[model samples]
Target chain A: MRRAVGALLRKDLTAELRTFESIPAMTLFAVTTFVLFHFGLDRSSLEGDLAAGVLWVTLLFAAVLGQNRLFVAEEEQGGFDGFLLAPVDRTALFVAKALALFAFLVVVEIVAVPAFGLLLLGPDLLDPLPGLVLVLLLADAGIAIVGTLVAGLAIRTRARDLIAPLLTLPLLVPVVLAASEATAPLLAQAGAEGPPGRWLAILAIYDLTIGLVAYGVFDFLLED
Target chain B: MQAPAILVRDLHKSYPSIEAVRGIDFEVARGEVFGLLGPNGAGKTTTVEILEGYRERTAGIVSVLGHDPGQRPRTLRERVGIVLQGGGVYRHVTVRELLDHWAHLYPAPRDVDEVIELAGLGGKQHERTRSLSGGQRRRLDFALALVGDPELIFLDEPTTGFDPAARRAAWQTVRTLAELGKTVLLTTHYLDEAQALCDRVAIMKDGRILTIGAPAELGVGALYRVVWRDAETGEVQSRETEDPTGLLHQLTSAALARGEPLRDITVARPSLEDVYLDLTEEPSAAASQEVRDG
Candidate 1:
C-alpha cells in the first residue's frame, strides 16, 4: 500500500514538474480572481470581512483551475494507462493524486495569499499569516479529497464538460463557506487569533469523511 | 497443494436488463498462454475483467491466485498484471519518468532502461507518451503490465491496432512471458494470433464458450478444400472433404484414364477462423461438444 501510494504521488509530482502547466494556470487564475475582488470592493470597504470573502472565492476558482488541468496532463500524454497498469491499489492512486493536487493548491496559495494581502490591502493583512495558512490547509485538504475523485470520474463521463463543475461546485460550497468564516477572526482580532477551533473542526470532519468514503469506493469505480 | 492460476465455475454477471456474462466456466493452467477468442460484445472482456477482480460476479465462483478478486486484495493484485483496452496516461512525463514511477510499485522490478528496450521504446525513452505513435503507446502499455513481473497477466485484444511487425514483436513478448513462467489469459479477434500464440483457446459467442481446445484439435485442418477444373466444359468444381490427399490421387487417376488433365486446381486446409465460425454458428452442436469435452 505504501509503495502504491508513493508511486502514484511520484508520478503526479514528476509530471507536474516536467510540464508545469497546472501551476501557471492556477497562479494566473488565483491572481486574476484576487484582482477581480479588489476592483469589486474598492478602498472604502477593504476590511477583513471583505478580505475573507475575497480569499475564499479566489481559492475556489484557483482550485478549479488546478483541478481542471490535473487530469489533462495525464490524458494529453496518454499516461493514465500506465497508472492503471501499476500494481498500486486504485484508491492509493486516488490519495496520491489528491496529495499532489493539495501540494499544487498550497504552492499557489503561498504566493497568492501573501500577494493578496500586501498588494490589495496594503500590508495591514499580512499580520494574519499564521492563522491564514492553517485555514487554507484545512480548506484545501477538503477540496483535494473530493476534487481528485470527482475529476477522475468526470473526465470519463459523456457529460464531462458539465459534470466536473456540477460535482465540484456542490462540494466546494461547504469548504468555501467554512473558509470564508474561519479567516474572520484573523483579520478581526489584530493579535486576536483566528476563527474558533470549531470551524477548523468542521473542515477536519469534512476532509476525513470524504477521504474515507472516496477511498472505499475508488477501486470499485476505477479499474481496467 | 498448488492452485490453478485462475478458476471460474458457473460465473454469471448481469446488468439491469441484459446479462453480459452468462454462467461460463473455465480454468487457465499455470504458466501457459490461454486464450479467449470472440467477436465484439461476445462477453470475453467481461469475463476477463471479472477474473482480474475488477468487476463482481452476479452468480458464480472465481478464484484467482486463490483469492476472490471482488474482495480486491492487494496481495492478489500484487501477483497479477493487466493490459487495459485503452485509456489516457499522464501526458507531461517522459516515457522513462513514467516508467520509473510505475517500477517503484513492485518490490523487484526490471531495470527501467531494460524495460524500455523490451517495450521497443529505447530511442523514445525521453519522449512523452502522447507524442508516441499508436504502436509505441501500446508497447508502453505492455511494459506497464509486465513491470511487476506478475504471475498472472490478463491481456484484452492486446494487439488490436498494431501493424504486422509490431504484432509479431508482441507475440514474441507473450512467448517470453510464458517461458519465464507466467500464466497469461488473453482475448483477441485475430484468429491467426490465437492459433500461433495460445496454448489452449476457448471460442465464445453470445455469453458461452463454444469450444475449448488446442488450435489443431479444434477441427482446424480436419477438413480440406479441393478445387479442380472439369475438362469437358472447362468449368470449375470444388469439394470439401476429410481426406484430400486420397481424393486428389483418385481424381487425378480417373482423369488420366479418361485422358483429361486436371487444370486450375487448388487445395487448402481448414483454418482456425473456419473452425471458430463453425463452432459458434451451430448452437446445439457447440453445447453438445462442450458437454463431451467436460
Candidate 2:
C-alpha cells in the first residue's frame, strides 16, 4: 500500500512539475484575486478580521482551480482504472491524492502569502509569520481532504466543472471559518498575537473527521 | 485437476432501463485465448467488465481463476491484468516512466525494458505518451497490461479502429501472450481478428450468446459461395451450396465437353465472418434454437 501511494504521489508531482498544471495556475489565481480584493474594497491596507477574511477566501477559491483539475488526467487517461487494477489498498489512492493536493496548496501558499504581505497587509509580515504559517497549513490540510473527496465525486459526473466548486465551496466553509478566525489575531495591526488555541483544535478535528469520511467513501467512487 | 481459467454460468446484468447481459454462460480453459465477438451494444464490454470486477452482475455465477471477481479481492487483482479499450495513459510522462510506475503496482512485475520490447515500444520509450501515434499508444496499453505479469488478462475491444497493418500487429501481440502461457479473454467486433487470434469464440448479440464454438467448427454446415460467368450471354451467375466440389466438377466437366472453359470461376467456403453474420442478423430464431440446444 505504501509503495502504491508513493508511486502515485510521485507520478502526480512529476506530471505537475513537467506541465506546471495545478500550482502555477493556482498561484496566479491567488495573486490576481488579491489584486482584485485590493481594488474592490478601495482600501490601501487590510488588518485583523478583514485581512484574514480576504486571505482565506481568496485562497479557498484559488484552491478550487486546483481541485477542478486534480482528477482530470486520471479520468481522461484511464488513470483510475490503472490504479484500481493494482493489488494495493484503495485508500492509498485517497491518501496519495489528498497529499498531492496538500503539496500544491503549500507551494501556492509559499508564493501567495508573501504576495499578500507585500500588497495589502498592514501588519509587519514578520511579526506574525510563525502563527500565520500554522493557521495556513492547517487550513490547507482541511481544504485538501475535502477537495480530494469532492473532486472524486464530481469527476464521475458530466457537469464536473460546474459541480466541483459548487460542492467544494460549501464543504470548505468550516475550514475557511476556522482559518480566518485563527489568522485574524496574527494579522492584527496593534501587534502580532498568538491565535486562540480552540480554532486550531477545530481545524485539526475537522481535518481528521472529514479525512476519515473521505477515505471511507473514496473506494466506492473509484468503481463504475 | 486444475479448474478452468474462467468459468461463468448463467450470468445476468442490467442497468436502469436496459438488460445489458441476460443470463450468459461460458467457460475458458487454462492457457486458452477466448473471444466474445459482437457488434456495438452487444454487451461484450459489460460482460468483460463484470469479469474484471469493474461492474456487478445482476444475476448468476462468475469465477475467474477459481475466485469470485465481484469481491475484487487483492489476490485476484494481483493475478488479473486488464487493458480497457482506450483507457488513458498519462500524456505528460515518458513511455518508460509510465511503464516503470505501473510495474511497481504488482508484486513481481516483468522488467520494464522487456515489457517495452514485448509491446513493440522499444525506441519510443523516451518520448512522452502524447507524442506517440495512435498505434503506438495502443502498444503502450498492452505494455501496461503485461507489466503486471498476470496469469489472466482481459482486453475489451483491443483493436476496434486500426489500419490493416496495425491490426495485424495487434494480433501478433495477442499471439505473444498466448505463447507465454497466459489465459486471455478479449472482445472484438472484427471477424478476422477473432479467427486469427482466438482459439474459440462466443458470438453475442442483444445481451446473449448466439453461439459458441471453435472458428472452424461454427461454419461446418454453412454454405459455400461459387461464382462464374456464363459462356452464352457473358453474364455472371452465383450459387450457395453445401458441396462446392461437386458443383464445380459438374460445371467444369460440361464446359470441357462443350469446348469453352468457365470464366471468373471461384469457390469460397463460409468463414467465421459468415457464421457471425448469420447468427447476429437473425436474432429471434437463433436465440430460441440456442435455448432448445441447452
Candidate 3:
C-alpha cells in the first residue's frame, strides 16, 4: 500500500512538473486575484480583518482550481482503471491524491503569501510568519481532505467543471471561516499576535472528521 | 487437481433500461486460451468486467482463481491481469516508466524490460505515451497487462485497431503467454482471430451465449460452399452442401464426359466466420439449442 501511494504521488508530481498543469495556474490565479482586489478596494495597504478575509478567499479559490485538476489524469486517461486493477488498498489512491493537493496548496502559498504581504499589507509580514505558516498548513489539510473527496465525486459527472467549484466552495466555507479568523490577529497593524487556539482546534477537528469520512466513502465512489 | 482458471455459472447483469447479460454459464480451464466472440451490444464486455471485479453481477455465480470476484480480494487481483478494451495510460511518461510504475503494484511482477519486448515495445520505451501512434499505445496496454506476471489474463478486444502486422505480433505475444502456461480469456469481434488463437470460443448475441465449442467443433456439421461455371449454360452456379467431396466428384465426372472443364471450381468450408454470422444473424429462434462442451 505504501509503495503504491508513493508511486502514484510520484507520477502526479512528475506530470504536474512537466505540464505546469495545476501549481502555476493556482499561483497565477492567487496573484491575479490579489491584483483584482487591489484595484477594486483602491487600497495601497490593508490590515487585520480585511487583509485576512482577502487573503483567505483568494487562497481558497486558488485551492479550488488546483483540486479541480487533481483526478484529471486518471479520469481522462484510464488512470483510474489502472489504479483500480492494482492489488493495493483503494484508500491509497485517496491518500496519495490528498497529499498531492496539499503539496500544491503549499507551493502556491509559498509565493502567494509573500506577494500578499508586498501588495496589500499594512503590518510587517515577518512578525507572524511562523504562526501564519501553522494556520495555513492546518487549513490546507482540511481543504485537501474535502477537496480530494469532492473532486472524485465530481469528475464522473457531465458538468464536472461547474460541479467541482460549486460543490467545493460550499464544503470549504468552514475552512475559510476558521482560517481567516485565526489569521486576523496576526495581520493586525496594532501588533502581530498568535492566532487564538480555538480556531486552530476547529481546523484540526474538521480535517480529522472529513479525512475519515472521505477515506471511508472513496472506495464506494470508485466503483462505477 | 487445481481449480479451473475461471468458473462462471448462470451469470446475469442488467441495467435500469436493459438486461446486458442474460443468464450465461462457462468455465475456462487452467492454461487454456478462451475467446468470447460476439456482436455489438452482446454483453461480452459486461461479463468480462464482472469477472474482473470491475462491475458486480446482477445475479449468478462467478469465481476467478477460486475467489469470488465481487469481493475483489487482493489475493485474486494479484494473480489476474487485465487489458481493458478502451482505457488510456498516463500520457506524460515513457512506455518504460509507465510499465515500471505498474510493475510495482503487484507483489511479483515480471521484469519491465522483458514485458516491453514481449509487447513489441522495446524500440518505443523512451517515447512519451502521448506521442505514440495508436498501434503503439495498444501494445503498451498489452505490456502493462503482462508486467504483473499473472496466472490468468483477461484481454477485452485485445487487438481492435491494430494493422495486420501489429495484430499478428499481438497474437504472438498471446501465444507466448499461453506457452508459459497462462490462462487467457479474450473477447473480440474478429472471427479469424478467435479461430487462430482460441482453443474454445463462445459466440454470443443480445446478451446470451448462442454457441460454445472449439473452433473446429462449431463447424462440425456446417455446410461448405462450392462454386462452378456450368459448361453448357456458360453460367455460374453455387451450392451449399454437407459433402463437398461427393458433390464435386459428381459434377467433375459429368463435365469430363462433356469434354469441358468445370471452370471456377472452388470449394470453401464454412469457416468460423461463416458459423458466427449464421448464429448471430438470427435472434433466439435458432439459438434455443445452445451448444455446450467441456
Chain A TM-score across all models, in listed order: 0.90, 0.98, 0.98
Query: Residue A144 in model 3: shift from native, Å?
Result: 1.2
Tens digit of per-residue lDDT, candidate 2, span B57-80: 999999999899999999999999
Worst 10 residues of 3 chain A by lDDT: A79-88
Off by over 4 Å in 1: A71-90, A125-131, A149-224, B1-3, B13-23, B220-225, B231-234, B240-246, B258-260, B264-269, B281-294
Summarize candidate 3's per-residue lDDT along B190-276 as a digit string, tens digits.
988999999999999989999999998898777889999888798999999988899999999988888888898899877888889
lDDT by residue (tens digit), candidate 1, A1-224? 78878877777777678778788788888887777667766663355666687778778877877777666655655456555545566677788889988999999988887778765654366677777888989999999888888888877667766787788989888888888788877866345365778888889888898889888887766763
RMSD for each of the candidates: 5.3, 4.1, 4.3
Residue-wise C-alpha lDDT for candidate 3, range A23-48, written one tens digit per residue: 99999999999888888999999999
Point out the higher-scoring one by TM-score: 2 or 3.
3
Candidate 2 CAPRI classification by DockQ: medium
CA lDDT, candidate 1, residue B228: 94
Q: What TM-score quantifies how close candidate 3 is to the native fold?
A: 0.91
Q: For candidate 2, list the clashing residue pairs, or say none.
A: A77-B88
Lowest summed lDDT window (length 10), candidate 2 chain A: A215-224
Off by over 4 Å in 2: B14-22, B221-230, B233-252, B262-269, B283-294
